[model samples]
Target: MGKDQDLLHAVKTEDLLTAQRLLQRPRPGKTKLLGTAKRVNVNFQDTDGLSPLHHAALSGNKELISLLLEAQATVDIKDQNGDSSTAL
Candidate 1:
């Protein structure tokens, strides 16, 4: 699956480990931590217009939500119903 699909799957299944892995990126030989993470498109919207942050919100996983936010996941990306993850 694509990174987007993987992110969504990780969110839906409440897989924090996988979600963290998705948000991370190796900088040549080093790695980017949450404080500096922004490699992946954590704001990417799915077919239904729900981003990974949106899914994380719905799932009520604080750790996942934190990770997404640190990765720069936009909180204002509206879904099909015109509601963002922050609304949850």
Candidate 2:
């Protein structure tokens, strides 16, 4: 699978290290690590329309939730069932 797919898998499996590494890559023409192109889109949804944030929150993984938030995951995104991370 590609890096983006790998990133989604990492988040689903709660693999914090991999997820963090992906998010930490430096963005082009930027010194900050927050906007890396190498990083997967935090807002990417699965077939069920659930974002990584939804998975993290649904699993009750507070640390993962925090990590995703730090990585700029959108908490307001809704799943297929209309459940946001906050609602999960």
Candidate 3:
């Protein structure tokens, strides 16, 4: 599979340790880690500009969401459709 897909999979699987390692590594072949899309950082968006915190709110993954929020992710980050994080 493509490298980006692999990385995205790691994030979705909640393998935060591995995802952190991959993000810290220099991109292979000039690829960027964060992507041009901000939501890509934590796989937070679901066809919107919502952050992972938003998902946590909906799914009640409080611990994981707390970690993301603590990491300085933009709490008010808006998506392409103007959806911002209303997650608590």
Candidate 4:
């Protein structure tokens, strides 16, 4: 497994706090961090193209979700498979 892949997994595991701290640290290149408490799409699921909001929802992270929404994450953004919005 690669480093980015591991980060994605951590995001999916609802480890937003860990992810946030990691994202705060500098990376070598482009991998810009969103700084939002969203989950990572490690597998890149089509239907679950879930951003941090999706992760927060599944984990009941209302606070994180609010923060991501404030950061302007599309509330209606669908996954790769067009599974409607993460709000669903």
lDDT of the structure predicted as candidate 3: 0.54
Counting clashing residue pairs in each candidate, in order, gives 0, 0, 1, 3
What TM-score do all the candidates reach, one by one?
A: 0.83, 0.80, 0.45, 0.47
Alpha carbon deviation, residue 20, candidate 4 (Å): 2.9
**Candidate 2 lDDT, tens digit per residue, 1-88?**
7666677788899998888887774656876555434557878888899887888887787887888898888888988888888886
On residues 1-88, what C-alpha lDDT tens digit does candidate 3 reach at each position? 4444444455456666654554453546876656543323554454554555565555565555566666555677676767665634
lDDT, candidate 1, 1-88, per-residue tens? 7777888889989999998888776658676567654456788888899999899889898999999888888999999999999898
Task: Output the better candidate (2/4) by TM-score.
Answer: 2
Clashing pairs in 3: 49-79
Candidate 4 per-residue C-alpha lDDT over 3-77 given as tens digits, one digit per residue, 9 for 90 to 100: 445544555676767656544435456565575335443223323476555555667767566555554555665
Highest-scoring model, TM-score: 1
What stretches of model 4 exceed 4 Å from their correct place? 1-8, 22-48
How far is each candidate from the true structure, as Cα RMSD in Å?
5.0, 4.0, 6.5, 7.0
Better of 3 and 4 by TM-score: 4
Index of the highest-lDDT prediction = 1
Please report, in order, the local distance difference test score of every candidate based on alpha carbons.
Answer: 0.86, 0.79, 0.54, 0.53
Off by over 4 Å in 3: 1-46
Residue pairs clashing in model 4 are: 38-52, 39-52, 46-81
